[model samples]
Target: MPKTFYQFLMTQRNPESYDTIANFANNAFLDSAFPKQETEFDPLSKYLEENAPYLPSMTIFDDAWQLYLASLA
Candidate 1:
């Protein structure tokens, strides 16, 4: 089966090679608050690492990030 967005994020061994972060970072998809542009993307990965404890155990990074943004609204 194909991986869900969350599974992809959680198991991403090399975020640099991952495509979504690059795409999302472009065209204001990601907020300016993001620490770095996609060229130097690690904060997203670091965010997953730092918040791993509090985030849901389910594999759904997209939803997790969405809710996080929603909280800011």
Candidate 2:
């Protein structure tokens, strides 16, 4: 069977919880209070690292929209 997006994200071993952090950052981008400058990326990254420490455990809850788009080819 093919690996689901959640499975792919879960299998990432480096940076430990990058997928989780990425998800949080993506959500922040949709918020009205989200910063428009690139400089805010680091702060958001830190926030996810600190607040969502169990990002890996929540893998199934996160959807891989980008992966779905890539599959259209």
Q: Worst ten-residue run, lDDT, model 2?
A: 32-41
lDDT of 1 by residue, 1-73 (tens): 3333333333433435544433333312333333333211245656545644433332344544554444435
Report lDDT (CA) for all predictions. 0.40, 0.41
Going through the candidates in the order shown, the clash numbers are 1, 0
Alpha carbon RMSD to native, model 1: 14.0
lDDT of 2 by residue, 1-73 (tens): 4444333433333443455545544444344443333223246345445555444543322343354335434
Candidate 2 steric clashes: 0
Tell me model 2's lDDT, rounded to 2 decimals: 0.41
Shift of residue 64 alpha carbon in model 2, Å: 18
Error of 1 at 60 (Å): 1.0
Q: How many times do residue backbones clash in model 1?
A: 1
Highest TM-score among the candidates is held by which one? 2
Candidate 1, which ten residues in sequence have the lowest lDDT sum? Answer: 32-41
What TM-score, over all chains together, does every model reach?
0.25, 0.26
* lDDT score, candidate 1: 0.40
